[model samples]
Target chain A: AQSVSQHNHHVILSEAASLELGCNYSYGGTVNLFWYVQYPGQHLQLLLKYFSGDPLVKGIKGFEAEFIKSKFSFNLRKPSVQWSDTAEYFCAVNEGAAGNKLTFGGGTRVLVKP
Target chain B: SAVISQKPSRDICQRGTSLTIQCQVDSQVTMMFWYRQQPGQSLTLIATANQGSEATYESGFVIDKFPISRPNLTFSTLTVSNMSPEDSSIYLCSVPGQGRGYTFGSGTRLTVV
Candidate 1:
């Protein structure tokens, strides 16, 4: 079974601060990566995904993630975060032949203070 | 992307009871997924429901405890049976959307008292 590991469990930052969340997965074959965010009292929403092609993938709300195959990592980053960006972020990996079955990492709760 | 409407956004049920959560998708899909998100935890895939076929459950989940129904291409239901406090969590349904990404439902918050 594939496993995902997130380096941080909680993050606190002031508005306009740069943010980065580290994610790593253990899977040798082709894999699809995703970042999903959930605000308080809301459902999980896709932040970005890496299926193939360019390593850097841009997503909604000014978020982006870079897929590094050699490192087995797809880390989420933002140049500057806003208070509205406060949410719980999760990293998930889908094995190529797994047909959308996602293995998720323990989530990281990010709190951006205004 | 496809839109998903899930029923009983939240429910407080007594222990040993059962609760069935329904998910309806706006578009037809081949497979529907059920997931559980415990408090302060990440989402865990429970099973995959295929239209007209038996649902495939992940390890640690069973058909008896989390029975799933996929009666058609656009709808499915997950029933949590013999609920206990440990079963209290947010249950979500997902389907593969355009561009290969997955769309998630609003989620059903189940609390066993």
Candidate 2:
């Protein structure tokens, strides 16, 4: 079975501050990585995904993640964050290309202060 | 992206009762899934509803507890039967959107008391 681990349970940042959220997954074979964000009272939306090719994947809203195969990590990063970025973020992994059953991590609650 | 409409956004039900949540997609999709999100936890997949066949449940889930129906390509329903306080969680349905990304519905908040 595939499992995801998010090191940070909660994160707080001031406006204009840089942000990074660590995500690691345990799966032996080919895997697809994804990042999702859910704002207050909104549905979960996909931030970005990494299926193949370049490990550095860019997502919406000035967010990006680098998939380091050796590290088994796909950490989300943003040079500058805004108050509007306050939301709950999730890291998910699909074990193989056969199915879409995603295993998600314990989410990270991001609170951006003005 | 396929748009999904879910009914009874939130409901309060007494123990031993049942709640059936419906999900209707705007367009046809090949795969539709149901998930549960407990308070302060991540999304846990309940089952995979296959059209014209029985649903495939995960390890901890069973058909009698979470009976699902996928009558067609774009619609599915999940029923939380004989609800208990432990069943108090947000239920959501999802499908593959553009670029094989996931598109989730606004979850149904089920409160079993």
CA RMSD, predictions in order = 1.1, 1.2
lDDT of 1 by residue, A1-114 (tens): 899999999999999999999999999999999999999988888999989999999999999999999999999999999999999999999999545788899999999999
Model 2 C-alpha lDDT per residue in residues A20-98, reported as the tens digit of each score:
9999999978888999998988889999999989999999999999999989999999999999999999999987764
- Model 1 chain A worst lDDT window (10 residues): A94-103
lDDT of 2 by residue, B1-110 (tens): 89999987999999999999999999998789899999888899999888888999999999999999898998999999999999999999998777657789999999
Colliding pairs, model 2: none
List DockQ, one per candidate, in order. 0.67, 0.65
A8, model 1: CA deviation in Å? 0.4
- Among all windows of ten consecutive residues in candidate 1 chain B, which has the lowest summed lDDT? B95-104
Candidate that scores best on TM-score: 1
Give the alpha carbon lDDT tens digit for every residue of B9-113 in model 1.
Answer: 999999999999999999999999999999999999999999999999999999999999999999999999999999999999999888778989999999999
